[model samples]
Target: MRKNKLSFQERAGSLQEECLCFCEEASREAMFQAPIELPEGFVIDPAEAVTNVTWNADSLSCVSERCFIETGPEPDEIAVQFAVRLQGTVTLLVSVSPVRNQYGQGNGAVSVIHSAEIDQVVYYSDEPDDCPDFSDIRIENLVVVPPFYGSPLSVTGTIVLVPEPDQRSYVFTANSGDSTVSVIDTEVNTLVSNISLSDIPTDLGVTLDKAYTYVLHGNANLVSIINNETLTVTQTTPLAGAPRKIQFETGGEFAYILAGGSSIYEINISSQTITNTFTVSPAADDFALDPNGQFFYTTNSGIWVVNKYDIKTGQLIDRLSNLETPNVIETPLIGDFAYLENGELRPNVVSVIDLTTFSKSSQINRLFDGLITIVFSDDGTRAFFLEPFPENLTVVDTAQHTMITTASLPGASDIAVTPDNQYIYAAQPDDNTVTVYRTSDYTAVSVIPVGTGPAAIAM
Candidate 1:
């Protein structure tokens, strides 16, 4: 009784594998979350050079789902390549290269305007007369019907291109109140770009190949680095301190900057500079990074210590003390354990810390007062945060440390979750909106508005 869909005629030239790949529900990891045009001039080349596998799918043209794209049209260009089809794992990719035209002898028909719950796939190039008659193919879902779509390319002439597909996921929002970062587009939730940041951004990261997005700025301590294909900010770099947390380094070379709370630099993601430096004798406003990459949790509010550094020689490996004013430090996308949070405006307490055994096992208390960010649940079992004088949103079950529900997000200032935990976005800076909850029943499924003071979010 499980059938959402699945089809793939798989044929080409001479009608041999001309192309058809339909997937559905959860079969073969069916995918294609939105944005699917591409037939007109076509322009999507996420650097277009795939080798092993790791594709950023989007709709019929961009070739959705687990990936594996192959193209070969060279009278002018037709190079779409990507390959990450896993199960037994077969890697072979090469997309984006065809742009030549005028090969239309009789008729053509290449359609997939979407919404049939898609996972669309396409392929062509077995000498169908060489294929390539898109003098103005145009697309936005794609439907270029010419005169040949009857199980044939019309006297053997087939040239139907598809290229518009760039919107699988995105949600950057770092509105340091107004310095701007915005971005959203998690498949049509909208607010596509907004970028302008000169100061105050404070935390946002992504780059395991999401193509770059590292912003941290508080009083201009700077770091700005964006380039998600060209949303531009290219690089800013400067940071002697003042910024506050920005992690990455699950082997992608390196990155970890938790500024002037007593320094901790170390970046170098392909030369975005700052190779190494780590100090914290009496500084630590926030910092956490040990998703198994090897420790560096810092959080101090009035001497309640919690430092642990040494994510590769930054030294000073331990100090865990009794917590009470812990500031903020989070780490749990996979866990070795660490949460911290502490208190300041009144009642607060998260403190989990258990990097294997560096101690302080559990806490989780919160009458409110502070907890703007802290997400986890890529199977870590749940743990979300955000509760500032009743802006409420807490959900946490991290293996039984309780508090399984709460929802009201009045002015919520930051939160992000969606690696499949279903959804939960909240960033309402006084109604500039961002909402979008539904981790099963937390409700409110859409809001979007974004800009003015969005605070922080990432994914």
Candidate 2:
């Protein structure tokens, strides 16, 4: 038999054609029968086989199931490539094949054989002149093996390409007993530092720009402004009376400080001076601002009343009465609805009020009596509530207006939800720890230890 030698161009073209065909078939299979969808703004690139490696049958025995193939200039292994353009959060679903010989163990086996095996998966951004280093690329999974011939093993994972607007980098918790503010790095879930205050810290408010954290000093008649970058108290503004709660404007230009009596002072951030004062009911305990910063909902602890006032003019817009101890007020990400934790004495419930009509739309009842704090999911479809006295956490579906489920926590004093809506953090003051539960399964994932009396939490 005579052997025919092929030219370099012919071999290259043949290999390219084979790669394209393989990719097309793989994509079709993935699209029709894939367990998960491919992330938006991303698509699988063609499978480019190594040209240096021979596909002859004699090489099949010597080939290892686990082999590394360098795709870029650096010597690194890559099973497949996905091209992405937009910058946002995305999850990748990848399918990999196991190493197997093309020819079966038979006497009349074919002369030419091919092998397919994928052991690991890695990813990196393909943009910018100075591409990300190898260290920046993350390996999502390894040691993946296909279950059957011509079928690829599938794996799913999530990643954040660009930082989310509400994805907090740090969380601030007020330890009243120790008179300190514990700063937690949300990325590592660790206590990075603690800022000691002169008096007991009652509440905390972080500016929109995250430049400073306003600490309300209990009975100190002052607000300690701690610079976030410096992690120290930069300035202290004296108030007329002791401040209980603090909320910031959208731009962080001014802060609304709820002091003793009926005073709500608007303090200028730059000058650290009280610019204006507005009066609500004599004993309004807590307040929540609408998303547009147009209206402020104030809850009166002593009476069953919630007062709505214009933020700019300080005029009474509407008053919702006939409630039981409406102490906490919260608006969802969308400003159309406001949830008020009311009926503290009997029939503990959350009043859902329409922001447009300023009327009670409905109420979520069957809650235990105790101090309550509420936080909404990022999408505003669900709400998580923390209640004391045989402490428990309840999740409510906003659209359905019903309680989805409840989990018992011995000392759940405070609760905060992540911006991504993946996890909820509940402060167990008596236990001196914070329990993190997964939003999808409602399973406790981690317990983070904090300072004594973790009274307040802000993310």
Candidate 3:
């Protein structure tokens, strides 16, 4: 049966409220009176003690609108030294007049200056009796952009921009603690679907070929293979114990489940069941598969590298121990080497594993207090970590294996990298906010609110 695919679109900007305007204008006029009779308490300061004096006025014809001015004793010639300023009680004045021609033709003469210095000014209007015209005007515009709001849940799991036929990116999130998956319309930045699952899902791995998604249920002790097309649970394969991490092989025919002890469940996609189980020496919390499917790395009580067997033999080829505490093991896409982030204190480390030798060649430590999640960039040039508890995401340059940038997450428990490598979404379990950051400059763009205890983030 053909499936009806929903279109997902990317949002241009976040949601916000409408902006307000700010245009206003005040009128003008001219007048001359008794200095606007001062009130009982309006006594001016002594002229000798004044440091500054200012005035403004509007004028028309013979009348001049004057603003009150007071200043300390100064030179009589400096009466025009009043300062210029703005206030609700102050205004400017304009004066106009026509002057008479010297050849006995009558015209008006006009002069303008600070009202306080009007006595020092002179007007030579040719037509002294003629009155010209004058007018006054005042003008004001408003500004517009709104505020951004997000969900309340700490974003755990991943967000993928699955391009739909309609040109939208279908956004999805996997919550480890909530044990629920949220589907969002990227274009609208709105939640459209929330899929409920079993106990805390630690890992989410999706495959488009078979239209199935494998979820490692950390507390449920099972691997849920969900049908992506139908958005329904197709099968739940029982594992040894808590399956904290799971990944699908490149061929898309088999899946690997890493559980509590030193065992890993190898399930067959055809039968939708666990066909064989491989128990390596030490136990592991997570595992990663080499893109080539020749070798798989699991973080046991230490760390172990196991070779793929022919069938249900459940035999391991090579394993390494006494290494650093390993959390998530991933193989960078650009090179054959693998990267591991140990989520332990004191000797917290990240190691570079040579796939061919199955040995740790180089390692860096104390990069952070705890690094439980590590994600490589799309091009495999950089790697990211979700340091739990003291919530923060740190990015490292893969070539140098050195720390590059760090972002504070506060109650952050997990992080997810978008397929495009544009944003890193971090989940804060206590704060219940998913912070989105730009990967290039590592600037915080937005904080998305979500439900309580967001435990995982993926994309």
Candidate 4:
């Protein structure tokens, strides 16, 4: 049987709301904003493209179930063509801005613009999938159709882009009390390995290549690199001042470690040798880098503030205060904002730092007091707050700075979301297990047993 492919053709600068008018320069998955001119000669063509594009004042990560083709802009106006892969009968939800420039810059915000359901069936994929067939048909001139308010279970009908499972299928947790690291495979919800370490692990991070997992021991003042293939600690680097967090460059070319409460040690990946050292405010044990590794943020408890520094120029960019503790700082993959937990001895607050203007935009204080830990979804649309009021979880809508949902699960210490945005894995130390909750309904789907006293989690 021959498949009838849907071909998309759009005119530049003024794209129809129905076409795939997404602009991504760094990665295939783009967080797009209209009227924001993109660089010239932007291009990418692959055998299969699954793009999760975000647009608007408050942003979101959205993806369709089908595959798409790349479309570059013309000189003046933007034109794009998308060949979407289909199977049976599928409904796609898309938000398009009224295009305004040749660079596919949208003039207006991407308000919820949904297209009506199409009724056509065709041969979608050459092979079969475990999931149901949604669409595989043919259509033309897919101009602006009637607005579609889709399925209730779809969560505002936003097509959630699922990342490649082969690369990010395992959730890593650090059991500080047990001095061991447990690897949980999300595919089967089973414990793959309980790696016993020599020292208490404080934090964990996986390399970009998925080749190794780096474990930092703050008390022992050393780092252990575990080879994922062997599930064994292959190499160990001893450091001073109680090393805290481990970060990698985008290409896995270099690694940076925060140690001694006031220094960042940079290591060349190829040689695993100390390439350079940089100093920061004393008593600052935690630091975070922007997604591109161009900027860094560190907390200075001496003044109870967080400082943003330009990594290239080694100059301060902005400083944030009003925090009681100001010990921890984190940024999302999109690099638009920073999340800092506040009020260790006071009220629990999470300050949102606007990266563009380098200022404090808003503070989320709805969470309960005691201890607050937040983990952002892949696209920055949502954040999971770990509240210590007898162990509970709160889901906040990042765009509106509103609480979306809540779950009371006793013993939940820390939380980490899957790359696909489908599930939340919370480390329950009180129960000596990790609870898996479905993002769609906040239901506990699985409670897999893990090592004791799980304190931290990473994807």
**Count of backbone clashes for each model?**
27, 0, 50, 13
Tell me the lDDT of model 3 at 94: 21
RMSD (Cα, Å) of candidate 1? 21.1
Flag regions of model 2 displaced more than 4 Å. Answer: 1-168, 250-252, 269-272, 301-303
Ranking by TM-score: 2, 4, 3, 1
What's the residue-level lDDT of 80 in candidate 3?
A: 14
Instruction: For residues 1-459, write the lDDT of model 1, one tens digit per residue.
Output: 001111232222312433433222222222222122336543333233121211222222332233212111112111222221222111112122222225523223222222323232332222223322223222222121222233211111111233333545788888867787888878778887786666778678777667788988867787888766545576688877677778786677788887888888888888778888888777887887788887687877888778887788878878877777788777765757777777655777776777889787877755556776777766778888776756477788877656777778677777778878888787876777798888888778799987887777787
lDDT of 4: 0.61
Model 3 misplaced regions, further than 4 Å:
1-171, 176-178, 198-202, 208-210, 302-313, 322-328, 342-345, 389-391
Give each model's whole-structure lDDT: 0.62, 0.62, 0.52, 0.61
lDDT of 3 by residue, 1-459 (tens): 112221221111111222211112211222221111122222222221111112332432232221211111111101111121121222222222222344534433322322321221111122324222222122111111111253211101111111122333434456655677654444455555556665566667655253666777777787776665434556767776887666677677887777885677888877887777887655656667776766566665444333333224555666665465566578764567777765446546777877777777887533656566677775778787766654366777878777777766666666666768887776666776677777777777777665446666544
- Candidate 2, 53-152: lDDT as tens digits: 1211121111112112222122221222222222211223334322123332212211112233221212222222322222222322223222356443
Candidate 2 Cα deviation (angstroms), residue 255? 2.6
Error of 1 at 402 (Å): 33
Q: Write the per-residue lDDT of candidate 4 for residues 60-137, one digit (tens) a residue.
A: 212232322221121322222222222221233333334234564435423233333222212122233422222211
What TM-score would you give candidate 2 relative to the actual structure? 0.60
Listed in order, each prediction's TM-score against the native is: 0.28, 0.60, 0.56, 0.59
Which window of ten consecutive residues has the lowest lDDT sum in model 1?
151-160
